[model samples]
Target: MNIAILMMQKNENELLKKWITYHSYLVGSSNLFIFDNGSTNNQVIEQLTNFENKEVNVLWDFNKKSDYEQRGSIFCDKIKSLDKEDFYDFYMVIDCDEFLGTVDEEGNICFDPLSLEYSLLNYQSNNELLMIDSQYYNSSISPFWFNKQPYRKCFFKKNTIAKLDQGFHHGQVTTSDKEIRTNLVHIHFHNKPYEIAKTHAKEKLTGRVSNFNLDYLKNYNGKGFHLVRFFLQTEEEYIQNQVTLNHIKSMSLYHKLKQLNLDWPFSSTINETREKLGLTDDDDSFEKVLPKFRGSIDYIAFEGEYLKIRGWGLVNYSRPIRYIFLQLTNRSRFRFEIIERVIREDVNEMLNVRGGALGFSARLKRSDLEDLTDVTASTAIVTFLNSECAYFKFDMQKKHKEFNYFSPNNLAG
Candidate 1:
């Protein structure tokens, strides 16, 4: 094989056609070999087979059991194999969205059109191994931090004698220098929507296996990168700082589409996928759903049968007559049985608290403890008069990695 392109995808369809078409135009589709792992949709495989390049092989059931992260590492090891006997001159493994290219002496694209073959030829003079840059682009394509693509795709060399390390970003051999000098950058356009991006962030922050880098927060630009901030900040805070949302809400979708770059059709893809997913009515604006509920239910505990609820005053409402009410309910049926009212007189003392948090508990009767179990695990909810709430689960706090906490001084109003 001269140059073989390897790709693995799951549950992806929208961009698979474009990726195959563009790359096939660059370096003959005969060199393309896609490995589909458990794609629930048949159209994804059907489209790949529908291409004119019938010689392009589609391994549909290839390693369906393994996950993306494991498959990535596997591809690194088996970088070469043709007809079960031949070896290739070089191997190219990339995601569905990544496109490769080369640059000239002054850091300008060398060719009129993108050709992986041309890029490889042009990058020969630069270095022994091409250091493909990790450049990201947003779907919206605003001229600010979202649209500007990185300029460091160093067209790496194809070492004829030895193999190199391989992964999503950087792959090198143990004996090789493993130096990354960006000669020509590979374009990685992130087409994931805000909703999907949140899931990806949660995976990075909490999942057992992840592709996220520890220092990604400091390296990537903040405007469009919320995956990093998802762990560092609250969802409410993340939405407030998002640039693409701000841009979309300010302008019409038709207006933004007019500015879409043909080479990067992410904006158009976003619109199409957004409609297909039936997410036209989705709301990401934190300000729209942020509750005006004055304070937070800081803590909740149970002493045998007695329920102890601690809370804080959120605001300094000069009116002293209005009191705080604690509504208690059983988790089994979630029916409110006890309503204890506490005086809203802790605002003055809460000012000295760390977060202006105060302590308030509701009364409990032996009859109220009928459904509450001591052996198996029991839970109860404490609502703050439609303002705020907290749940008290027996010993569940230790199991949870993240918990919501609040300060009384931080009023929603």
Candidate 2:
């Protein structure tokens, strides 16, 4: 059967090369369709140059900006448009970090092309979207740090899907009860090197922050808040240490690598993947140290049901601070949930700290503030790193000299 695989790309050069090479070997390079999302990096540009006159087709027509909703809409619409062309038998949409492979009924991963094709053929069903399960490999933890779950990527029979949701996690199908489950899996490299993963985190949060309005901040706590925390932690020493550990662990796995039919050029293991791509591993050892917290609550105020806050905090030995809490005391003390963390590079430079995400910009809900309203100027406290805390005083009535005056132009109707 003819198969086409679709993926979107930005600046992930190394991962992109492995993806292209592996998928090209699985299905011919002629069937690979990559939508270049306006990559400006020289390495990616140079690599794209090598594919000229090659069968691999790279299209540059999709919207390149970081608006995910619009980009996702364009992606789904493009797929629907391609479905009309009648060029291929089946289609799969996945991210660069994901790899498509097949597993046996006993759950052993298959690497041979014939075995993979046989499994797909046996599982194929009409009027259904095949839901391929996923196994997330967190190399930062260890090469063996993997768990299999029902998280799926779409493997669609033509005309089975009407449109996919934003991330292509699920879709609106052409008919009800239209899913065909299979042992096909997408091995997800969720955590990569610090710098690359950091860039990815920043891009994701930027898209979220730009599109989600502040009026809905209360309802946006869970996923949106976690993204901010992750983006802030991108530069910390712990992440760096985990990355080094993964490399070290993968080296051990490489020594015992068993032969497979396909002799797969790309590995789910970080060290093996790097070696296959001709990249060197860092053999240097890193020491993990406990973090000590010390921070200041620079600004805090109530703006309707939303509380706006800003501050700078740091760990003494350059470790990442995961969360910061705001405790308000009256007849009773209440601790509010932190909504977001911000990177404070200026704080780091000024303090001469080696590493840490030392700044934060957060929003807290007034309803969650509860009945603890006896908060005077001195009742507000900020805490971090479990044991360290700081308190600051501010005018609740907006009468403090630093915050008293304002000039306005257009009024909301």
Candidate 3:
């Protein structure tokens, strides 16, 4: 079947490359449709152009709208045009931050979208949509740590007549009557405090956002949603690390009444759906399943200063070395940012330091220096000692040798 993946995004430069890579791997580069909204980065356009030349279709609309209504209207119009041209048999509306997953009857893991029986997937909603819990992680503050809570659902299937709902959280399946019951998992990426703030700010500014309340989202306590901790050490660690990561759930009845902004009583709708599905919020059936190591490293610290982190860990081979160093000299606390700076068994150059290499540096302010020292002492340092590197001989007493920090730009030769 011909399947088209639709994505609407604004200022999505950070996720653009990785999302495009995953989409290209899933359905090939030819079946993707990207809609850009007010993106400031020209690099995104250039990348999309390259993909278009390779068969992907890229559409651009610069109209600024504070609500999803305008965005959805534009999306629907574009999809209608594509449908009239007989571009696709089935189209999936996916978010830039979500990754779709499929599971079998026997509960085997399948990551490929095309490998599953796509006909069984069904979209259900109450007056309120059921929020799925997710974990939040920050690279700078916490060492790749994650907390979990529930958030609103944002995936749906569309045919020619399908249009997004008023709040833009769910969609109406207008053309199909198929009672498909496929289970698809949504993996979200907004896990940091800064990320949460930015998202909430966007939603508040954009009046057309989802109707979901921000308060109900709770923090995950290291123990991921529906997963239990195992092993003596892990159980102890779980108990010790009682930190809450951001998660969102439907508001309680009283809170729902207090924040009664929507027309329908969401509490009642949620109850009815829960009863119909024979599912209880307290169901912890998945707790017995041991957490599988997806080979994800939560956080890496280097000298309590520079940090190299992957939200979901380093899953792709193309990811460069995740090593950075924080330089604390008399002048100031300089963060040396390096991306793939490890050259043919030697250090190349350093990107940013307090002062240029081979130069005398001034002292930092007393208060700033104290603060930097405190941060450096508390931060965790991660080093890839296993990776190839050259040994440097330094003369601290002689003060005779000059050294240069390694950076990508300096090594470009």
Best-matching candidate per lDDT: 2
RMSD of each: 23.1, 19.0, 22.5
Tens-digit per-residue lDDT, 222-310, candidate 1: 32344565546543343335433312111222222233322334456456655654445434321222122234444554444444444
Ten contiguous residues with the weakest lDDT in model 2: 404-413
Could you say which candidate leads in TM-score? 2
Per-prediction TM-score to the true structure, in the order listed: 0.46, 0.54, 0.42
Residue range 73-136, candidate 3, lDDT tens digits = 5656666777777646555566675544443322222446465335223332222222222212
Clashes of 1: 16
Residue by residue across 78-172, what tens digits does model 2's lDDT show?
Answer: 66787789776677788887777775532345544576678778655666767775443445433443333346566676666677765777766
> Which of 1 and 2 is ahead in lDDT?
2
TM match of model 2 to true structure: 0.54
Error of 3 at 350 (Å): 53
- Give the TM-score comparing model 3 with the true structure, all chains together: 0.42
Sequence-dependent TM-score of model 1: 0.46
- What lDDT is reached at residue 306 by model 1? 46
